[model samples]
Target: MLPGPADTPPGPRLEAAVAAVAAPDVVFALSRDGQRTVRCGGTAPPPPVPRERLRYELGSASKAFTGLLLAELTRSGRLSGGEPAAALLDPRRRTDREPITLAHLITHTSGLPGLPRDFFRRALPAWHTNPYARYADERVVDAFLAYRQRRRPGTHWHYSNFGVAVLGHALAAATGVSWEELLTRHVLLPLHLDGVAPHPGPAGTDATGHRRDGTTPTPALDAGGFQAAGAVRGTPEDLLAFVEAHVRPSPTPLAAALHAVRRPVLRRGLGHRHVHTMGWFQHPTAYGPLYFHCGATLGQQAFLGFCPGTGTALVAACTRRFRARDTFVATAYGLLAEP
Candidate 1:
């Protein structure tokens, strides 16, 4: 079994950091020096939320997993990274303009729009109970078939949930297995992460995602439609373990692929640089570079990030959406700072 923080105590500096961010029910784990680790916080005491029960909606963090899967397939020669995405769709569905390749999808450089307009206006309300709960594979295919190229495929980067969704379809078509199955076989199982489950909550082990406000619970997203886009949920420790595995140097093909995924790709927004390797945002900090991502769905706000340089990972999740006065990246760094 992987020894956690209990095996190695944290220093005073780290403990103070945890106390500072203790308000929002934050759960954090760090493995500086790659082996010695420390963890703090919980929804409650005496095992506040068991790693199994503390399910957090990872938001776009799922994109990193998707990118890793794609990279692994490409490295193993099962799929071609350079193949145009149009090849995966029916010819009748092909959009005009430059071709989109798997690389473009991984890098968010395909120039596709953030999401189809219909998704927000039409599909969103009905599925609003679960946002993406009702989106089916058939609708995904139809959307791809009907989509028009909004910009050239490789010239510029644009973050598009729709593009990643299409890539998920392409992977499914290539592997002859559903994306959920692929993730289970390749990621969850290998990482010994039993807590990670596909969207809509796996049978017998998952928590409902609630809005920040006290409104009704949002319906879980259908993993089939979101696929590798934004569907998995798990506890912060499970997420930390996953990060630890990536931080370690290994010769396995998957390990190498994960390393590749952390490569910086483009600039996302203020103080945030995008990583196409695994769809994470890289934020440079005083300690080192922090690889992080945040998600917001109605009333929920979630953030997960770690610095490979420092072996520090911070995860924060809230039932209600909370806007930050300063960038979360800065806030996190400030918390982890040596006092």
Candidate 2:
């Protein structure tokens, strides 16, 4: 496990690492000791791009929030992690696929595919505009129920966007409320994460995510039914605060829920040694247990991680999809894991 920074302010080393990343714009935040330091850099960036104010699509990092919501629900006894999802979903629409539990979906071991095949069929037609915007909750649930699993549940670790999305629907079905409302009540409201939203409002200026070409505008993807899988966007300050909550427990009433999600659930061999938590991918490094996850939209990319033992968290979001995003993540990990 990486040791906690010894009262050392993140200095040139961190900046140089981010500078080496190939993105049109990048915002990063480090949280420790109840304080956060945010930094931003880019070439000819548009207005409202300050370190604290810049907003980017969190991509799969949003899954952590969904996982937290699941944990919270379990703590409240509203749902059981081990119960069959068929209990929550409508009976008429249930699929022939093997019965899965809420825990299976949260841990990505439900054997579901990353997306329903029909999702691509619907999305490809409007590839440039917004593939996900039209997929409402009902549609997502229908697609999920009709699909077949490629593997047996809990046998192997496979990440599935469809699994998480179905989990969200099940939660909503059990609660009789929209998934957004569930998230707002259980996580966002308690955390006071005002800047986090499923959709970008006209009031705030968002950093435009650039296409892989680095010139074209990235398609505008919406949360729709996959809202739980990906679709949250937030300012750097808001995201940093979210990470801070995981670094240490927040004072919110949902503290138990927050702590519950961080508990390591299973181990996986993903090239690097990794322990999968409810949402976050966890690793034990020489310094400490590293909890991390990365996100990507059609254009934007995001990375977030923290070590509980060290009380250090790294939150980075970038606009402009590029090949070096992985390299940038490795560099950030190297810096954070340093002694």
Candidate 3:
């Protein structure tokens, strides 16, 4: 039987912190001091949100899962993180700027810019529609090959959707399996997380991503070329479950790989300082050292974080595009810190 809220003590303070933010849907789940698992907001009676209906877009947060998959592939000897990314792709199809490694892709230090310069310019008119939806895989690959580099690989950290997309391609080539299948088999299935899916568009119950104005709904994300970067969708409860597994993980290699990804690679700055480890961001918090990640698309906002010290993980998903301002992260940390 599913555990009830009584078995899982609620973090009222965390709930209040989320409430203060006025987020459309907030889900705080904690597993501390044994089998305790408490959920507030999303699943409560007179529910702030319908538990089964709200599907989060996951934004860049999808990188964490992709990172885990890559780590697993490396652990199994199917792929190597140290190898240059160009080695996997056709040389004629790769950019000559510099050697981009899988590690650089995972760490977001590959010197690749965040997004294509014309991505917005070209896609803005259909901004609410899934712009990348119509672009074929060949188009995505061509964009990468045609693009020029702004800096040397591994010299600095700049989040790049294209970099991760390349990693996805490499993983597929190495494993001879599609990225979606790899994620489903290696990550979701092992964790028994049936709620998570590569593309939420076909899932009739998935939540709709509303524009910033909250009046119009955006097209469901196109997973064709963006699956590795930001295409997964799931409910807040499922996300919290995934975090719990990370906190007190099993002794298997998958769990070990997850821990390996959390190791700090680069110093981002004080409380807000960050280390872009495998797929997640490591940051210090009042609750103790925590690994967190937030994602934003044109029409959605999502935050997923877990405090290992307290065995607490909180996930907040909203329909409208919310700014990833300091206040957003601070608010999440505040909820996680409450005892």
Model 3: lDDT of residue 139: 59
Q: What C-alpha lDDT do the candidate models reach, one value each? A: 0.62, 0.77, 0.69
What does candidate 2's lDDT look like per residue over 135-168, in tens digits? 7788888876666667777887778888898998
Count clashing pairs, candidate 3. 1
Best by lDDT: 2
In model 3, residue pairs whose N, Cα or C atoms come closer than 3 Å (at least 3 residues apart or on different chains), thus clashing, are 269-273
Residue pairs in candidate 1 whose N, alpha carbon or C atoms collide under 3 angstroms: 129-219, 130-219, 212-299, 212-319, 212-320, 261-277
lDDT of 1 at 284: 64
Q: How many clashing residue pairs appear in each of the predictions shown?
A: 6, 7, 1
lDDT of 3 by residue, 1-339 (tens): 122233334655445554544444444445554344444342123333464346778888888889888878877787778867665566455445467778888888878777666666766666567776655565566676666667887788777887787778767766678889999999998888788887764545676666655556676777557678888788766787777777877754378777777677777556536666788877666556788788876667777877788777777676566554534456665555554
Q: Can you tell me which runs of candidate 1 are displaced by over 4 Å?
A: 1-25, 34-53, 91-97, 202-204, 214-219, 251-253, 267-276, 286-288, 324-339
| TM-scores, all models, native as reference | 0.79, 0.90, 0.84
C-alpha positional error of residue 127 in candidate 3 after TM-score superposition, expressed in Å: 1.4
What does candidate 2 score in Cα RMSD to the true structure?
2.9
